[model samples]
Target: MTVFIMVADVFTGAHVWQETAPRLAAAGSEVHAVQLTGVDAGRPATSASIDLETHIADVIAAIDTVDTASDREIVLVGHGYGIHPVLGAADRRPQRIARVVYLDCGMPQNGVPALATVPDQALRAQLAEWAQRGECEGELVPPARDEWQRWGSTAGISDAALDRLTALAAPQPLGTLLQPLRLTGSVVVVPTTGMLCTRNGVSIDLVQRLVDLGDPMLTALADSQVTFFELPTGHWPMLSCPAGLADALLRAAAGEGRSLRPVGAGVPPAHLRPFPLDVPELPRDRREHVDLYVPDAEGPRPAVVFVHGGPVPAGTRPTPRNWPTLVGYARLAAAEGMVGVTLDHRLHDIADYERAAVDVAAAVELARADPRVDADRVALWFFSGGGLLTADWLTKPPAWLRCLAASYPILAPLPGWGLTGSRFRPARAVAHAGALPVVLLRAGRETPEIAATVEAFVTTAKDCGAHLELVDVPNGHHGFETLDPPEEIRPALHHAMRSVVTHLTS
Candidate 1:
């Protein structure tokens, strides 16, 4: 016999699983939608003392209720804050949990609270500040129906379902989120399934990319027991498409979803690849975050400040400034009668682009302040994800800013990034880049997700009549600078360099 337990929190309950649970039962499984302590619908009075431990105990009790003699396969499906109790229960009863499902959630770490795992970074900081200030002591009231997207995407949810959600949603007990999660090492090896909500900013492909990055912490994601699935709907799949969510859940239980493997067969990691250029390495003025590659035959010369892409691992050694490709670009710029600048920005997570932008701005200021750099003539070159940083300079091109360039860039924010009202959207801001020479070195063979963003920005730039020069590397990949042969990409590299130099010098 197979037993499935459902868990969710904050303005929702087992009731949210109302539509999906029956479908699971019909498909030959016993389903239990475990209502947690303080927010249990059966109890009208919410005890302030009810915390995460209360709900964790509730799930364990639900698991224990299943007959032991029947020999059951227990699958715990956790959504949002519900994952806390599910994980807690799984930790205590690792032997009983057949599989664990992570449904549209920011993966919570052992020592962190649910609040720390929130997808919205700004909101997370705001909530933490509010809690520390003692503004929301007892519980956090549910967001209004329209504000639901602040927590997660609401793309596929219908009006009636949203109304129901608002009506049934309960105040999330603040204490439940305040306590740090404690876990035993036993739960680390549990078989896991991840159901990604593509509209919520994660997909199987994105997860695969992260796993491919070879981060030891994320390597388990590529384990054979861990599989993945993508739902086209938004965060609330149970409310949006119960039938589909039910079907996926059933498939997940059967291990019918996509399996991922780490990138180690033949292809070298993108960053570890050798720099494509054979330019003479120049001595760099290694300041803290910003590094300057001064030209040998230079007075005060034009500077091309290279901003490397990331939300790279914060602990990544030989930081961006020291990366061969970045160093190569700086040297190449220095060889072309210009100052080459590279900087380390804090883009260690998807939510950190804002802070990263600040770092970029400060780095640029630092570069311009140098006596070796001609502050009146400067170009900004961005790579990969750092391409989004072009928005600010494009929107309000300074007199000293000669040109802005991006190679294989993500100009707009992905949907799931939840970067609403953000200024880092070059696709939209390019319209304001009047007379600002914008050079884009696009990779023809870029990843589909990133390619789509590039295409959007290109279309917008053309329509808005922005001064744009597009150079296409038809056979190049995302990090083609190192991935492709030196001979193939060298011309394109030199062409882009000359273009930026012309904008700076001409």
Candidate 2:
């Protein structure tokens, strides 16, 4: 495997690359570390203040020096701000690059900005300030040796290695910080996991949210042909957990889809289960049908209805990825002797798309009328475009449906919000906000339109006195399954559902 390591801002030059490259080389990977100009190390890059274009050129130059025609495939790995240059370089010479690994960074799609698309203005301002001052010489300047040493050790790094790193580091250029990348090809992401480390102590809840949302973007990229791996480690894992990090990269080069456990394979974590159900058309303008997944049990249980994204007429069903989560809940409910239900509604008929809200409302009525269900504990789990239907269903929902969980849900038909251009406007989602306790989750790395759609729902619903919590999980994409499901992401939805159950039953 030919692994080319791209360092992030303020961590550049031969020193950083030298340390990382040789290790990968020894591990059977032909390695190269890209040193971008602009950030002043001990020398000047070009005396000209560097920009995004310059940084991009710097990456290309490094790649050009490598013998890509050799038997080995080239694996490009970028960390944080390094993604900008790597992406630019890949766009220019995608054919030469086999796998682009984004280390602790979200994989941006075809056209996306480099800056964090976070809505928090204060955070953005802080970042802008950091970018403005982060670079000095042609080389990237790392943090003070002491700070890095502390970071490394905490991340499971060795002291001797830290001393070595101190000697071989350089300053990075600042101009590349604001560059917008146009990624022509897909890139796999290894997102920085754990915690929203504030100036204060760790915010456990915030950190969980970040990890949950951030990890999903990796899945989305994988779906786009860019595979991903969910490594549970903090930022700069290479320093803190070098052995683990190296092994992961090496395994990635070897094309291992899932993480490899150590010698002792522990018992597999408990998984969710459910029996698939098929529902026939009661009556329709034309012959239409529906399928449902009702939890297996001896008695009636609470049901959760899901509305998938896209026009109902486009044909939608609950995905297998979601089934595990739903099954987890169903199992939990069943353990407590409660029922779990997943319903499919009519939207395949073109006429029903516009009437999705009404159609779903009728479905809830059907769920409520079903003798095998407990009407009081029913809830709504809406995803993407289906969010519109969910939001609308909540307007005057059945006596049941005590809670609503919108997974990357769309809130309105506002321009750029997904449903506006679709056959049915999403505004119906907003018109009915005061229905139940709502938990909204948005992908921290989703497209602007999707983010805005989710944001609209949270903002509007919050104002209506609904019990609401908005969690921004890093690495999540539109449907929230950007990459394969990691266990960390699973618990959040389960907790959210359990919270709803507790709130309703209590």
Candidate 3:
């Protein structure tokens, strides 16, 4: 196996990988360090015109130069700013890459530039100031060595190495930071691993916090088939904990600690049988497949269509074909003697709500048409962001839809993804709803914005004469059912699931 290590930059990469690459090579792996354009000591400084695409080209060229035959499996590793170019290169040459590793750096999402993806708002402001100053002088922004020292790890590196690193540092191209990443969502096919540095006390919990806060980069990473490994070191793990980082990367490449069974495995005994519902119209790459969990009984059974949340921003790909929470609900539906149908719908930006709605409708039609499902007694289960797409169906629900179950749904347009004159407003939809029952599951510790949306939906639905039942989980958060809440909250979780099952069964 071959490991292509993309150094964070001319200086940091030189210092960080000095110890790490040799360790990987000693383990019988070939190592190649990527050198970006205009990053060497003798090379001329890059201009504002030198951008992310240029660095991406450099990475691809390096890969080509090192792997002439392209027969060996290549592991793509990136650190700091290097992650951006490496991601771009992976997008370009996904077939050649086996695994992608992110080392103590934020992941990048399509359409988000390196500068915009910086997690620290204060740092973003400082960089903006630097860019402004550079613009005034008609020169590219110079590298901030002091800022790098403040943020980077100096723990394991000797004093001599630190001095050498400082001396070798070169000014980074401002355009690379300013340029937004472009991806076709295909890069997600390559498995990704995160080597997180915990010296700053950053843990998987912190990553989850970022996901909860809707950090686009973290959210995208979480949605992918990514595993995290914690290293008790500083931000530059390659320099601070090279040996440990090397071991973690090797383990990740070998798929250690991952489930041996295929994805969407571990369905409980309750789900009598599970099978995929094939839709020929959708391309295989789109992953628009559904799984049907039918009860053991022979005759037609009452059914509930489970729709997962996340109209995940456009250009982002969801890794797992089926979410475990939704699958659990499917099993619960089966346990309650009803057929459970979990479908994958197209997740698009708010602007493409209509297209996604069509996917939902297609899923419903498929469920109703199945001989195993009782067409006249079907129900719809909407979770999280998928709740927003239920407006039309809720407003003028069909005769066959018995009820609707919404858990921590986003009823209104989320902050940044709002659309003008859109018909996908839950508050307005409930005003025109038919005589159908709706069960609303509210999480107590949900973010304020989501809480407000739930509250408004409940209030407006009641005022509009919509029949609604509220199930309160006092100790739960937004993803309580899936988050593996404490034992105390288990009863509430079961109760909520039961409420939905009972409503659909009734």
Candidate 4:
């Protein structure tokens, strides 16, 4: 029989496992849920001063309760921020633990605080500053009941459950988040299992790609002793799909889950590979290294500024202006008697979007000032990750900005990206785009993470009665503009361009 020791997450108590615990107990296994200080409903965390070490002690105690069971197998499962305590206890008592399961959370490294795992740059920065100033000694309030999505993905969770989650949520000890998770590195020998919740922006496919990158920290994830499973629900699987989680946990304890292929098993990500599109080569002038595909007919023509999606590598050659897809779009616009402009903005890292937005805005200002451009009739088309930049324009579109277009774009930050307070979230800002015509090219075959953003934007837009047009490429992939063969994608591509062109010229 397996003995399962569960650790709850931040702002939550052991009750979070109420739905899943019984199932494990009924399977002839022992289940114990650790109730860490500052998060227990009975404890009343009204000014709790707890920290990481406190939780570590709590988990150690939980482990002790089942430690005397000589005939039973012991497994430690950590969900969300609970992984810190889980890992800490496992480190101090490795000999007693058979396997450590990282449940829907990042692997906790030694000497790093749980707060470092926060996905939002703005919120993370503020918290870090507060921690530095000793302000984190106070309790950090949880998000309001209805705003659960802001905390993490709420896919699979119903409103009633959400309301309960909010009502029962505790005021977390900011110190707990601000303190480092110290490990003695003794748990290295412990086998591990991971459950990825895809709807919350993590998937085995994404993990495989990251492992292929050869990042040292992620490389260990490919080891044979580390098994993996995928759950299609969002965060809080115990609440959303408790039964499914129970079965997975049982299979995981039995070592029945899939082992990730070797580190170099997969090729580089599809986006980093060569573009598959074929477009006509055209003579174009590149001022300041930016591509300006000019029409033969006239000057002072309407220019469509093309912004490439990326936190692409800062040094990736053949910058956005030169990519075949951007090149094709620029040439297409030029062919239609309009100027198409493409510039390489410095959006090289996930956290660099804010500065990258500055670069994009500057590029647009420069495009408007160009002597050959008609500043009054310009359209801005963003691609891929660049889709986030649409927020600034949508929020307060200038009279001179005629239209906005995005092709398989990431309108909202992924739940795992830690961007709860990011201004770059276009889905939230799209409602502000009242009369500004917007065109979105959606890839039916898009990754679930990016698709979630589209779903949010579309739903919000419809609710607000925003004038939005969608071009669905039934078989298109996320980067289909460059990845799909021109023949298969041309019809949708042409329709999107025509819509933008009509908005620009009309």
For each candidate, give its TM-score against the true structure. 0.86, 0.44, 0.48, 0.81
Candidates' lDDT values, in order? 0.84, 0.51, 0.67, 0.83
Using TM-score as the measure, name the better of candidate 1 and candidate 4.
1
The segments of candidate 3 whose C-alpha lies over 4 angstroms from its true place after superposition are 9-11, 42-48, 66-70, 126-149, 153-158, 208-224, 257-506
lDDT of 1 by residue, 76-168 (tens): 999988888899999999988889999987677887777787666676777777657755447778888888877787878999999999998
C-alpha RMSD between model 2 and the true structure: 13.6
Question: 213 in model 3: Cα distance from truth in Å?
Answer: 7.7
Clashing pairs for model 4 are 119-418, 119-419, 120-418, 120-419, 309-386
Pairs of colliding residues, candidate 3:
none
Q: Identify the candidate with maximal lDDT.
A: 1
Off by over 4 Å in 1: 38-40, 133-136, 158-167, 208-216, 240-244, 256-267, 275-285, 295-298, 442-465, 472-495
Over the full model, what C-alpha lDDT does candidate 1 score relative to the true structure?
Answer: 0.84
lDDT of 4 by residue, 1-506 (tens): 89999997778888889999999999989999988777786555544578888889889988888857477889999998889999999999998998999999878888888887765566778888887888767777887876667557888987777888888888788888899889888999999999999988777866764565455667788898999999999888999999999999999999878876674455544445543444446687777746788887756999899998876655555466776667888888877778889898888667888888888888888888888999999999999889999999999999999999999999988876767677888998989998999999999999888998899999999999888999999999877854676677889888988898899889
RMSD of each: 3.4, 13.6, 12.9, 4.3
Model 3 per-residue lDDT tens digits across residues 1-506: 65655557423434457677888889877877766666654334465367788878877876666654756677788876788888999898888778888877666879877765443344555556755565322223333544444444445556665566667676666667776789987788998887766553345644653354333544555544777787876666666678998888788777552221222335321112232221112111111466777777778998888887764533333322354566667766776777777776666433556777888898888878878888988888888878888898888998888888888888876432324357878867888786788888888887555676788898999898898888888877766664533564556656766766666666
Report the lDDT of model 2 for residue 89.
78
Task: Give the candidate order by descending lDDT.
Answer: 1, 4, 3, 2
TM-score, candidate 2, is 0.44
Q: What 10-residue stretch in candidate 2 is worst by lDDT?
A: 192-201
